[model samples]
Target: MYEHLEYYGVSKKVIEAMNKIDRKLFVPPEYQDSAYVDTPLPIGYGQTISAPHMVGLMCEYLELREGNKVLEVGTGSGYNAAVMSLLVGPTGKIYTVEVVKPLYDRAKKIIQQLGLENVEVFLSDGKFGLEEFAPYDKITVTCYAKEIPPALIEQLSDGGILLIPVGDEYVQILKRIRKHGTKIAEESLGHVRFVPMV
Candidate 1:
């Protein structure tokens, strides 16, 4: 799996996390057979797990540190949060939200089954951001939103980074937004397709 992710520029730490966090654990039982493949598997609620390459690229871009607190907007299947949790280690915390109640419940159970206590799942509208757990060191959104949420910006700590897909439901630009004091800088990572954010 590490070798496969090299083409996408994943770091050694991220690759190790990917290897250690069995995709099978995060995937739905019905799709367990496709877990290790270099493909996206469907989780219910019409959301698909992000492709491995995309996952690799995002982690590489984030440059996560140990104990970093990450806020993920869409916790579909908990795969992305699980992968990130591994790299950030037991000391790190991931507060992820899923708008769909069922997905949120399933993801929470899956993470617990994997013995990850650092991850927390919330069933709420992700667009509003999780202000209760403010000052996130990093923030990421799995689904595509028309624009970056101002509330998300408000939740990020100084010098924090947010990676989100921006544009229409079907076609969007992957952007990396960084915060420096009161100013925020945005970079267009590329174009990609993803599920729409509720």
Candidate 2:
């Protein structure tokens, strides 16, 4: 899987972080055989764990550094958050939110089982962007939104980066938003398909 990711131009650091977390562990037993195939697999609740390449791409774009706090909007199967946790290291923290209770409980349990101390899973509407831990250095929204949620932007620290998918339910454009003082810059990373942000 690491070699596959490398072939797609995934950065060495992101691949290394992905290697530390077993994708199979984050997937359901029925999908275990397909875990390393680099495709999104359903994890119940009509949600899917993102494809490995997409996860790599997002991490590479986010430019995560050790000790940098991150906010992940969609917890899904917790695979993405797990990858980010390693990139951020022990000193850094990952605050992830999921609106679905079952996903929230399952992901929280798996994260705990893996002993990822820097990750915190919350059961809440991610659209709101967990204001209690505002000013995240980096923010990633795995689910697609009709538009970039204002709460997320307000919570991003100055000079912070945010990655989100915006458009209709069928397809959306992945946008990279940067916050510089009161100015916000947006760039398109290309089109992507993801579950709608509810």
Which is the leading candidate under TM-score?
A: 2
Give a tens-digit lDDT track for model 2, residues 1-198: 576787777898899889989999989999999999878999998999999999999998898999999999999999999999999999999999999999999999999999999999999999999999989999999999998999999999999999999999777999999999999999999999999997
Which pairs of residues collide in candidate 1?
A: none
lDDT scores of the candidates, listed in order? 0.88, 0.94
Residue range with the least summed lDDT across 10 consecutive positions in model 1: 1-10
* Model 1 lDDT per residue over 124-190, tens place: 8999999999999999999899988899999999999999999996679999999999998999989
Per-residue error (Å), model 1, residue 9: 0.7
TM-score of each: 0.95, 0.98
Against the true structure, candidate 2 reaches a TM-score of: 0.98
* Candidate 1 deviation (Cα RMSD): 1.2
The clash count for each model shown is: 0, 0
Q: Best by lDDT, which number?
A: 2
